[model samples]
Target: METDIVGVSEHRFDGGLLAATRRFEAAADVTREVGAGSVGVAHTLIALARMPGGVAAGLFARQGIPPDVLAAGLPGGGAGQASDAGAPRLGRLPVTAGLRAAFDAAAATARVDERVLLIALLARLEAGAVDLLAGYGRVDLDAWLTEVKAGRRVGDVFGPDGAIDPAAFGPGASRVLAVTVTEAGALGHERYGIALLLHALATTPGGLLEQAYLFLRRDVRALREQTLTLAGSRPRAGRGPAPERAPVPDEPVRQVL
Candidate 1:
């Protein structure tokens, strides 16, 4: 059996044959964004927990919640300084209850579609901001996809004007796409080594996913061919060697959704 390594973030997760965990995590993260948890789920949960009108700190005395977390009329007005800047409007709600209310408001707007909020949150996570509460989007795919898929009309998601701007696309989108492809395609399949190559090809889009699908179909075919070859099966006498390979022409397809 062959062994291989797969890298994610900054390091590698290695395994024999197929490497599964990290790819699952990456896709899970996107799925979380697409319909699961928004990036702010942690904070949101905390906020929601405070809905009963109590502090988050006192819940588990043994856990030692921070005392500075009291609700603020707005972020940064009180104890939220401990919260990270990238935390969604976290710094804004001094009290846990208020912070939760903010989450409720966002959720209401999100139509409770966790995936939409998650992707938007991922975009914000990518960008390092939460300002997701107010009007005007996070101004990126993470935000747009979250809002659009949730229920906000794509037009509303994109804004009053209709435009497809690369500037509007976040680098995080590429990160999301690349990571998703790697996980779904080949990373370390015993039958096929799918690493960066799969990541690159499948995500290249426009039937590449199709090509990848065909390749998998070919995998089954390969098994059959290999079995027949081992069984002494032979091609017909008239069937000649495969023709010389030729460069395929290029064609563009519709933009990625």
Candidate 2:
């Protein structure tokens, strides 16, 4: 799988992989803007660093090598040029064998995301761009990768009101919450309950809750069924005893019907 980069074409473009695809396209555009014959590790790094809302961008920012600085330091000095509307499309150029290998390895893992792609690219860093990046600052790739993977813990998803925002967490948490919110909304629920959260934990991939299930050797499918059953049960909030009421004085018990 690591030998054939073309094999990535065969994989489904699910939500996660789709985001990875956009990163690759951005890298290709950077290659063209820099007048490189093909997409190299440097171009890929620049693209990742420039990507909006990407974990890689945040990591690069933390390392003091912002996207503009990285682009200016690299060859061709095409800082901010890739965003040109007339820039050549990614399909017009070829990708380096090293980058192809990285893509192949990332795809082989069957868990493609920004974090996974960033790790793959950094692992294959070569001499030219690696030296330039190091000159900027001591780029601690391992620490950055750790931050990308586990920056937002599951506990951090809860807000001050003790409600889970779902969007507060990282990609793994977002995936889980996406399913939970969709399923709850389909059932005409205004708020997702604990049972939906459990179901999401059983179904979502690459999350801490899923790891817990694997560590405990528990049956996720069975747990999903149990949680779905719980969804059907009435909420416990309004199930308490009726409130006390004062007795009414005897008046006319007239039935005007």
Candidate 3:
């Protein structure tokens, strides 16, 4: 599965679920610090699921596909252009097994359409839903990022520009460090991003309850927005776009592998 979902890796589904929840919560922690604004982590979770092929991958995996088969948008849709629900629609939208399950459920249960997910992320970030999780004093996000990037402790990473500069990390992990610790990037960066967000939220001006609600709002907003796009999904046949194969009430009719 490419998007964040509940059903990936029966072999490791439990572990994956726990990790994703932790990651999502951590990212939410960072978003909590902004103005008591109205953003929610549901928004981010759904957004991740609805990202282009993000939905497809999740559905494909949930329906039981091998790693190799996920390349097709639909399980039996075959190669190139003609995608099954598993193939990435356009461009390489990063998809992990956990992400796929999230989107699959979104597509199935929660009325999240998918495109709204993208729009939500874009809008919130553009809106600056929440600014930096925290500024430096003792253990800041920049400091946290730096520490993780540097592969050292927080105290060791304390230097100019806060978080360990990208140079501190090897080429692979460097780009994430360069982003300056965004809410979306939090989970993507592995444990470091999640930890920093958690630390920032844990030390918020408001209590933990208010902080958690802030994130919930952001998530809810993102999920709601995704419906706008997901409901509009359709199959296109060449020159002009085609009508959606499945409407809201219509059960999606797909071929099995």
Candidate 4:
């Protein structure tokens, strides 16, 4: 519950948390522009839905979000005009107690497993979080929130089994890390957040989640190339192509009668 110098509660600003914070700020800007005069979950979802076709947007589309709905929800002023030149408008968008609690919980859960950051965002229903999730077909939002409230172990939001080891980020997750760094670099940011992770999941080297995207885009070659690239980078352990299997010493062809 300790607030940082900026007056917001302290949380892990390393990876996805940083990203979510930035998006929250942007959401507040949108709220201001739309004359809502306060930041809330509705603004956050609308901001996320406007990711311009990346893993972030794909996250929503997978849940059957219609483009028209997003269009209807977008804040109407000139989008993407928020700049870093002046001091941040943080004073205008005060972080509520609910949001601070969510941040604290996300930080604690993320310590065990960073991937569950999304779940933290979903756990709190205030600010249109549940409504946004329902838009993405989260029929079990109540159950999920309950589990989070009960202090369940952090794991994949969509996984059916027990908790997965957070340290064991899959191939897709590694790609997400790389892409996130790349995105932060592009933005001249020293750190990254969930937005970049979402973008990465929507684009290059997506694991299972990309299946739907590939089906829609029909870009199998890119996926194949990505797989090959990861496979190729693996250590051979002093093994060299299995010695080409010695060409199997072809037997002389028997003359067919």
Candidate 5:
């Protein structure tokens, strides 16, 4: 992909997930605040650290570099630093080549999300940013990235513990489930089952499950085959009236967000 200079709002992502878009917006804000000529990976990292309620912020917190401390160490702020009152405000600055390359790297993933973007940004961090981050603490970049890729399942929706937790299903997961249920109904199944769930996951383009498969270097076809075999072995509950046949939708389930 060509790494052309592009406006932050105009940059495109593979999945077009809202979280990814918001992160870029935050990076743009950071770039403007620092009066940089263009947005860079460093600016995005700073944005991720300062932005609350995201995976990056949580990771930074784990590394003992909370938002306030990170901000204090940056150029604009900290003890004994001159105020940035006269900082120039540039309009619609384009993203730097390194930043664009980071986005391109993240886009190469099965699904682009905050976790993937953060890893890409960190991988492409400039030496100055690395030094700046090193001042905060001993930041093991590799270990931090491993944690990002191995996402937390504290309240995973797919698990039994989080099955009944309303908060577990975010917009993305909710869309996947909605498609799964619709496909199940179309198949004349009285209740949702593992096979249908797996089918939905394999078919849903740009979903989290697909991303996992890619990250693990596994094939989606293998998952589908396993699901089918498992379903075939399970005996049906007590005989019930046969469900009426319905045509499956021609188009695969797609997540719009």
Candidate 6:
């Protein structure tokens, strides 16, 4: 599909998710600030999820993805560097092809139907992600999104000048944009957000984003059966026959901030 990506000629899902993920990674690479470096998509999503009433944050909290855990993935606050104020600045990290592929899958799965990747993330339901959404009680995907988005619009994180200023993005802005823009693209029929969520799940692996996507896309009951069958086939941990391993439901569906 042809998309209207900013600062790019043709439509590319990478523009949305890739750009944001790279920015966050870049932020982590530099700025010796505490709770900041080696940032991952999961870390960024957790940051945005923490946004007031943010879907990802709520879900992450429910699934036991703590702030400290997310913080650990971020760069340090220049601990013990108070004396060396003349430290050289860090440079930006470039986006990778693997990240781009992940976003592509997510966008394709959502079929470019969603606007908010956060909403989509919650709705998707991968294993880890399901744990978070589980407490919500029989989620109505569309209704849930409406409630979360109530009276709000997608705001620009850019500064007054039409420039891609890294400073303005702040701490975990890279992660936040990763999901937010994809949401925008989903709504705008842009491929970026679709790609963003896709990429998030891949980077996160068994993390919340992947779980959420699995839950939303797959058949819950059938998956339960499959999970059980696989578990039963495994050898016991210590006993004659290890008790049948509980099947963790692996449903595939569809993310946000």
Best candidate (score: lDDT): 2
- Reference-based lDDT, each prediction: 0.29, 0.57, 0.29, 0.43, 0.55, 0.35
Q: How many residue pairs clash in each candidate?
A: 18, 0, 34, 3, 0, 45
lDDT of 6 at 54: 37
Model 5 misplacement above 4 A: 1-23, 75-91, 153-257
Question: lDDT tens digits, residues 79-176, model 4?
Answer: 23332333233436544444444455666643512234435555544533444455545546566446434543333322232212222342234455
Candidate 6 similarity to native, TM-score: 0.27
What's the lDDT of the predicted structure labeled candidate 3? 0.29
| Per-model C-alpha RMSD | 17.7, 14.6, 24.7, 16.5, 11.6, 22.8
* Model 2 CA lDDT for position 214: 80
How much does candidate 1 score in TM-score? 0.22
In model 4, where do residues sit more than 4 Å from their true spots?
Answer: 1-11, 16-23, 45-59, 66-91, 110-115, 127-139, 143-257
Q: What is the TM-score of each candidate against the true structure?
A: 0.22, 0.53, 0.17, 0.40, 0.49, 0.27
> Which of the two candidates, 2 or 4, achieves a greater TM-score against the reference?
2
**Model 3 Cα lDDT, one tens digit per residue, 1-257:** 34433232222222222233343443233223322122233224332332222332233233343323221222221111212345322122223222333344434433333332222232222111112112111213243324332343433333342334323222222222332243223223211333333333333234333346576774333432343233332233322322222111111111100
Candidate 5 lDDT by residue in tens digits, 11-115: 344342355345356666766666565666777777766644456666676677765454445553211111233321123555666676676787677656567
What's the C-alpha lDDT at position 228 in model 6?
A: 30
Q: Report the backbone clash tally of model 3.
A: 34
Candidate 2 stretches greater than 4 Å from native: 1-6, 10-14, 17-23, 76-90, 146-257
- lDDT per residue for candidate 2 within 117-165, as digits (tens), equals 6777887765656667676568866666576656556544455544444
lDDT, candidate 1, 1-257, per-residue tens:
43211111111211100112232233223223333222233343223222221111123122333312312112332222223433332122222233333334444442322232333333332211234222222234343344434543323222232222212222233333344333323222111122332333333433235345666675333443443343233355633343233111111111223
| Ranking of all predicted structures according to lDDT, beginning with the best and ending with the worst | 2, 5, 4, 6, 3, 1
